[model samples]
Every structure is written in structure tokens, then in C-alpha cells.
Target: MPVYKVYLDQVFLGNLVMNYAILWAAAKLSRVPVHTARLVAGAALGAAYALAVFIPGAGFLQSVWFKTVISAGIVAVAFSPVTVRMFLTCLGCFFLASFTLGGLAIGIIFYLNSGRLSSWDGIGKVIEGNFWPGILLGLIALWAAGRGFAALLKKGKFENLFRIPILINSGGKQVRVEALLDTGNQLKDPMTQSPVVVVEYNSLKSLLPEQVQAGLERDGEADIWNILGSLSESSLSSRFSAVPFQSLGRANGMMLGFRPDEVVIERQGKLARPGRVVVGIYRNKLDPEGSYHALLGPNVLELTG
Candidate 1:
């Protein structure tokens, strides 16, 4: 048996380029912010994935769990957990790039070898002999292809369209809300200069009395006086304040209101406290099944101010 000498050549260079290209493509597709650190991390991951095959007794590294963990680790280091949308986008891009490159390699190998393409036994031998070279070459090729595809799509526009989840808190309960940051939701209470947080009536019904909920559903405006009279006796009555505002269509209805002890918005791993927010609970459903309880409209000044 003769040992074959493995050498890096133009083919290996081509593969390395491909690997970087794929990583760049993945980053763009996912709309994840890419920097030198992220690129380096992705490249390192690709190399590790390649090394997994050649290291004898490193069988554990070949498992699905190992691969997933490795990939996730790379993503976590590269992307921040700012919003669900961003996270999903990054993961989608990564998997898509990986599959595309792997498929391309398999296709090319099959085409070159024709009907005499190597079986698993022969393939394993080839991999074992030229493990490092193959890993480097394959990653480069995949990365380059991915980058080219990403470039064709244009990175900036794709990222601009990515929406992130909005975090809202009212009273003591916190709800993770998916809200499109609409610049058009400019509804505010003129007197107090407070941003009116709009919420569907049904969303907060769970927090209201059954009778009050039913009355709100049946008699909309007619139930206002009665509801207010009842609220006057409740513990929230002392804390409640009248916020007069006319809806787009509805002529009259008292805006049922509450003063949230505190309100926090989480974005990009940082918490923003927009205090003295007036939460308006409505009687209708904003969306099917009431996906959101309330919308944090605009900020209002505190009574002390």
C-alpha cells in the first residue's frame, strides 16, 4: 500500500472562496448584521465541520446534535437576540446555504464520475486520505456560491423589511406582542399629551368581570355609564382617570383606562422604560382570537408633570 501525498492547489482555493461566499449569502438572506467577527466565526465553523470528518475517534462530532449545536453556537455569536424575526431569518439563511452547497458538491462529483461514481466505501477512503484539503475546498466553494446568490438579491433592502417582535407590559402581567411598528399609529390624548395604547375589548375581557364583558359586547356605548359607575367602587376606581377621545367612526364612548405601574420595551437586548403610559382597553377584537392585548401608542405626561 502506498500513501498518497495531499497538496493544496487552485481547486482548494476555489473551495475556500465558495465557503466564504455561502456564509456571506446566508448572512444577507437572514438579514443578520454582518461584520468581520461574524465572517470569521462562520469560516471557523465551516472549518470545524470539515475537521469533524477527519479526526479519528471524534465520531460524536458527526451526530446531528453536534452539528446543530455547532451551528447554533456560531449564530448566537454572530447575531443578537433582538427580535424573533431576526433570529428566524438568520437560521433560515444558514440552513438554506448549507443545503445548497452540499447539494452542489454532490451533483458536481456525480457528474464528473458519471456512472462510475465512487460508492460509500471508496468515498470514505478518499475523504480519509484528503480530509483537510477536502474540508477547506468544499467550504470555500459553498461559501462563494452562497455569497454570489446573496449579492444578486441585494442585502440592504432584504434586511430593511425584516420585522421584529414588540414587547409590552401592563399592570403586573407582561405580554410578548408581535406589532408592526406603524408610523401611522399616531393616536394620542390631546389634553395629557399621552400616547393612547389601543387594545381590543375582547383581549382584556379575561381581566374584566363577566357581567361587564357581556355588557360591553351587547350595549357598547349604552353600557359606558353603568360600567363607569361600577368601576367607581372597584379598587381601580381611585387610580382611574377620564381620557376623552373620539374614535374614527364611533361618536361616543368612555375610554376605559388604567395606569400601568411601569412599562418596558425590549429591543436589541436592551430594555427601554417608557413610563406613565395610559393603556386604553377597547371592546372589540383587534385581530382574530385577540393576538395582541394592547398597543403602546404614544407616551403621555405624568399627573405630576
Candidate 2:
């Protein structure tokens, strides 16, 4: 057996520092609103708990359930007025931030002590090497990473980070795809002048008749409007439309469009329907990895709000 001792003042100080770090990291990573006074008070309360739990008669504080409740209290005080879903999201980010900071601290400590640890014989010294430097460096690295991520989000690619599920119901046949919201998509229906969602040929090909698919395959998009005309006799006649546009290195281009009976967007456990939108068919893959099968333009994507 080994002897163990913890000082009250040390526990209080350590917990204060750690709680603030965790709170800051979680807020930055999770994008949760922060009230400075509330957060500071919450961290202080957490530190008080640390000191309180170490008191000689505090046996109940050692239980896992008690600790979990304590964590919830700390989070609630720090980020008040948060929805349950958002609170859970913040809690997950808190855990992630804690783990990442721990790993970062440990890695820096190990790196700083590498080859110089030959004189030390115990695990305590190995794990506890140069605490202040490790903490300072870890925090600096965290801040830098947060800044880099924020910069990336500001680069007009924020919409591409999340994939939204959209269901297209045409003539009773429904096709669903994960859509990447593209800010650069300016394609719109020339007639109604509504927004258009660009989808791959393969994904929406099932929504078309076999004859139309054969015509598109034969003439390679040149006969897409003709194919839509032929589909006039089929069940998918009115669902088909066309759009004309000009792009880089190409002039006088046309894309096949589909006017589905209903277009539903699934996001955050809610389904939304947007009006005056057409689906544009793309001949090639928007993303080669197939991470998202469809691309949503701003005109229609805003309707999800």
C-alpha cells in the first residue's frame, strides 16, 4: 500500500484553474454563449466542491452519481438558458475539451522530459514534469486551433460543413440524398425564376422514365429537354423542366430540372418544406467522395430556417 495525501488549498487552486480551462474550451469549441460572471462563479463553485469533497467527513461526494450531478450543476451555472439538446451538446464538448487538454498536457510533459527522465525512477515525476509550462503551452495551442477553425468557418464554406437530408417526391417515387449547401450555386429556373438544387444524374435517374434515361445517355445532356418533352406522354411529364445557364469555359449550357410534388428537408429532428424550387441534374459528381449526393443553393437552403 502507498500513502496518499491531498492539500485543501492545492485542490481549490487546481480545480479553479482546471474548471475555467474546461469552460473556456467547451464554449469556444461548442459555440455556446458565455456569461463571464456566471462562468467565473460556476468555476469558483466547482473549486469549492473540490475542496468540500476532500473534507474528512465528506464520504458521499466520492460516489460517481454525485460527481455526475455536480458536473451538471457546474454546466448549468456556466451556460444558463440553454435548451436541453444544446446543453447536452455543450456537455459533450466539455468532455472532449477535457480529454484534449489532458492529452495535450501529457504529450507536452512527456516531450519536455524525453531523454532527461533517466535520473527519475518513479511514475509521479514522469507524469508531473513542468506543470506550468505544460499548461501554458497546451492553452496556447488550444487558442491557436480555435482561431484557425474560426478562420476556416469564415471562408464562405460554412454551409459545406454540414450535410442535410432532402427528400424529393416525384410522381409518387421519392428519392432522398444528403445535400451539401453550396453558397456559389446561382442556378435558377428561367421561367418561375425559383432556386434550383443541383443533384447528380445517377441519384435522380430513377425518378425518370427508362426512355428518358436512354436519351440522356445517348446524347449526353444535349437532348435533356427533348427527353423531358418525350416524358410528356409518361407519368413524369409535368414533373420535368429545364434551365439554361453559362459557366466557365462553357457557353449555352442547359441542365435538366425536376419539379417534385414535395421537397422536404430534414435537419435537427425537424422537417421543412420550401416553395418555388427546382431540382437541377448534374452530369458529374459534385463531391468525388460521395459524402453528399446533392448540392443545395442558398435560395432554397434559407427556407430551412
> In TM-score terms, which candidate is top?
2
* Residue lDDT tens for model 1, 1-305: 76765343433444445545566767756544567666766666656566555567889888999888876766665665434445555767777877876666655554444555358877655545454455455566776665675575443323223233444454556555443332223445544556666666554554555545665677425355566677766776543445555453364446666455554555567666665566566666544443444544322212212
Candidate 2 segments exceeding 4 Å error: 1-10, 116-121, 156-158, 163-263, 266-305
CA error at residue 117 for candidate 1, angstroms: 3.3
Q: TM-score for each prediction?
A: 0.40, 0.52
**Window of ten residues with lowest summed lDDT in model 2:** 153-162
Candidate 1 Cα errors over 4 Å, as ranges: 1-19, 52-56, 81-84, 118-305
- For residue 246, model 2's alpha carbon misses the true position, in angstroms, by 41
What lDDT score is found at residue 127 in candidate 2? 72
For candidate 2, what's the RMSD? 13.1
Q: Tell me the tens digit of each residue's lDDT in model 2 across 1-305.
A: 75667677877877788778788878876665577887787789889988887678899997989887888888888987665556776778777877787788778888877876666564457775477678778877777776777677545346456678899887788989989765445577987787788888888888877876786677434587677778878866776787876541256888888787778998778889996678887777877667788877666866656
